[model samples]
Target: MVNYALGNNVITQIGLLVHDIEKTSRAYADFFGVDKPQWFWTDEAEKAKTEHRGKPTEARAKLAFFNMGSLQLELIEPDRNPSTWRESLDSNGEGFHHIAFVIEGMKEKISLLEAGGMPLLQKGEYTGGRYAYMDTFKDLKLLIELLEKDR
Candidate 1:
């Protein structure tokens, strides 16, 4: 059995990068026969305390979520800022971005992943939790997002 670094192997969410979240989200809703979920912008830098590559950034993205059973599908349309989302969209074109896991010890998990060569790419705060994006693409073929919800 292989022990995972982020504590568990369960993926809670799958994120996709898109040029037009409005159009892409509508298409997904249509394809899935569900109503188009409402989209919202991420918190601004002041509120989110967003950082990219270890520096503070004002990066933000429009996001929409679709609950697909146990996993959520996230559509991200990033602004013209330096975020993991923007970087991936620009470098790789619009497509799959990351898979997220709900974690407990954010700092410890980040340290472990970074020590293992998967350095932290970006991180930010949300309403009830914080999230960090790890640069795991080279080995995992996709970025890994660690979501730590406040208790």
Candidate 2:
């Protein structure tokens, strides 16, 4: 498995970049025999809280999620440019993007990782949570997304 962590827990989500979220998500769910996927968009105003490279970016995407036992598989369809998803898709095509771990003390963890040379590539908010994506692809072969939920 891709080795990364949040606090003490292992990475728990498998994220992917996709050209078509609904199609890819349904295909993945069907292939994995999982339940229907949950959907979300990143375009809504007053979204959780977000920053891209230490600045606010209007990056957006359509996302679909599937729960398979202990991991959530995510498919992202890029809806805006100047975002990580777009970059990944543009550079690498459709495939694995990042793996995530939801944990406490998110900002602190991000700081530690950033201080250690892993730059913060992208960050954004969801309904009740926030997330930061660290550029760990060189070391881990995949981006690392750190999630912090306030519920």
Candidate 3:
């Protein structure tokens, strides 16, 4: 059954974690016939690493955004960091890592999920908007997110 917390009529993004950014992006672009994606580093994520985890190192993440009809596909490749994506790549090779769904009441959802089971792995907002990395990997091996889009 699909999780209703993700809401209806919308699933903003599907995040694909890859080991090779360029190759993966190109493959998706070719297969789906979509525009080239924009690559970016998660600046807010890096800062949080310093403050929260004390691992103040900059890890490269190449992001490519594309519109497949209506749903957005976000491809992410972590540059050799031993984070979740990296570990997944190292252990399982390049494949689907997470699916990020845009939602309202993110904070409340976080609490509700925590109360139920999924604990937060990481949570923060960037120039775009608020996002939370809640750990639901134990069951699904995927990171579940609640995103509040930034205007």
State the weakest 10-residue window (summed lDDT) of model 3: 48-57
Per-candidate count of clashing residue pairs (backbone under 3 Å):
0, 0, 0
Most accurate candidate by TM-score: 1
Kindly report which residue pairs in candidate 3 clash with one another: none
lDDT of 3 by residue, 28-132 (tens): 788877766757777644453411122333444667777876677777787665455566667887777777777878777877777767777656556667777
Model 1 TM-score on a 0 to 1 scale: 0.96
- The runs of at least 3 residues in candidate 1 whose Cα sits more than 4 Å from the true structure, single-residue gaps closed, are 1-4
TM-score of each: 0.96, 0.87, 0.76
The true-versus-predicted C-alpha distance at residue 138 of model 2, in Å, is: 2.7
Assess candidate 1 and give its lDDT: 0.93
Determine the C-alpha RMSD for candidate 2 after optimal superposition of all C-alphas: 3.2
Query: Global lDDT of each model?
Result: 0.93, 0.79, 0.68
Question: Using lDDT as the measure, which candidate wins?
Answer: 1
Instruction: Give candidate 2's error at residue 31 in angstroms.
Output: 1.7
What is the per-residue lDDT of model 1 for residues 1-151, given as tens digits with 9 covering 90 to 100? 2234677789999999999999999999999999999999999999999999999999999999999999999999999989999998999999899999999999999988887888999999999999999998878888999999999
Off by over 4 Å in 3: 1-9, 44-60, 138-141
Writing each residue's lDDT as its tens digit, candidate 2 over 46-94 gives 5635566777767788888887778887888886657788888999999
